[model samples]
Target: MSELTTVARPYARAAFELAVENNNIKAWSEMLSFAAEVVTNPTVEVILSSTKTAQELADLLINICDDKLDKRGQNLINLMAENGRLSVLPRVVELYADLVTEHNQEIDVIVVSAYALAKKQKEELSRSLEKRLARKVNLNCSIDKSLISGMVITAGDLVIDSTASGQLNRLSDTLQS
Candidate 1:
């Protein structure tokens, strides 16, 4: 895991647990997502990277976020800022989102293909993936001309590479061996 993820895991877990306890996962998710976006903005990033005091950093983030943050959300920002981990908010949000998806028994799947998939094809693919993974699947399709043909499906740590180029590479490796 990347250092950022390592640093973010605990914070994400805390946020996730709190959300679950409060039965406010949706609100927490929105708050984190918005905060992540704000922190990633170029202007906000410049200010965050400055040598401002921790309280100042927290105040800046809280002000920018306005009423988007609930009391708990503001506390999270204060804790992160005080610990000099404000920059890790984006990673924290990502990890927290993954936790929420898992809790909801859902998975986001990415399919990169040589061409756009038809509506029926996408539905079929989603159904197949849902059955195989035993989870609700959210399909995101994208075209990657380099695939030459076929597509690649990715979900969490799993990757299914059925592209023509991928097959050729595997076949070449076998023949060479």
Candidate 2:
């Protein structure tokens, strides 16, 4: 996993720089996402991992992607194919998304609650998180009955756990200590 990420970082950074220069971050993001999906298809994965020549693999991928990828994007795919790095495309997409979020000065936050949140509640939570994180917050809400009650807010490395299960665990730890 770490090896893939290490190999993918340079490619993702190059793509990010190109996107920034072209002012086409959104387009590049969509293109990379589509390309990643294509590369991950079962047939495509088999082909990629087979004994085909680099050019053959590159052509197959480019043809599969077709009009969704621009010339530079195609070039990226070709380069990765030539280097036997096509399998790292998914990691590149993940790193690219992180770059895009940072460039846009936005952060993604996940809220796991026992039940659905009202629209008003979501808005309030977003507002509160934005104030705390000092960045525009994009909230992704999910339901987890195991939480029992309340919610867990996760913004990157910071986790604010308010769920009943979480509280009980903390109490248990205190008692144990």
Candidate 3:
């Protein structure tokens, strides 16, 4: 995992820089995401790991990608294929998304609640988080019944555990200590 990330960082940074220069961050993000998804398909994985020529592998990906990738995107694909780094597509997409969020002064936040949150509740939570994090908040909300009640809000490395189960665990730990 760490090795893949280490190998992917430079490629991701290069892609990000090119996107910034072209003012096409969103386009690059979409392209990388699509490419990542494509690579995850079992058939595509086999072809990628096969003894096919780099050009053949790149051509297959580029064809499947269609117009989602422009010239620069195609070049990126070709470069990765030629260098035998195509396996890092998923990590590249992840890092690219992180760069985009950082560039846009936004954060992707996950909120796991005991039940569905009302639209108003989501709005309030977004507002509160934006104020606290000092960045535009992009919320991805889901329900986790195991939480019992309340929610767990996660943004990058910060996790706020306000769920009943979380509280109980904390209390148990404290008592044990």
Worst 10 residues of 2 by lDDT: 144-153
Q: Which ten residues in a row have the lowest lDDT in candidate 1?
A: 139-148
- State every prediction's TM-score relative to the real structure: 0.93, 0.93, 0.88
Q: How accurate is candidate 2 locally (lDDT)?
A: 0.94
lDDT of 3 by residue, 1-177 (tens): 899989898889999999999888888889999999999999999999999999999999999999988999899999999999988999999988888899999999999999999999999999999999999999999998888899999999999999988899999999999
lDDT of 2 by residue, 17-80 (tens): 9999999999999889999999899989999889999999999999989999999999999999
- Cα deviation of 58, candidate 3, in Å: 2.4
Judged by lDDT, which candidate is best?
A: 1
- Rank by lDDT, descending? 1, 2, 3
lDDT against the true structure, each candidate: 0.96, 0.94, 0.94
Candidate 3 residue pairs in backbone clash: none
Candidate that beats the other on lDDT, 1 or 2, i.e. the better one: 1
Q: Give me candidate 1's TM-score against the actual structure.
A: 0.93
Model 2: per-residue Cα lDDT at residue 134 = 95
Candidate 1: regions farther than 4 A off:
none
TM-score of 2: 0.93
Model 3: residues with Cα > 4 Å off, grouped in runs? none
Worst 10 residues of 3 by lDDT: 22-31
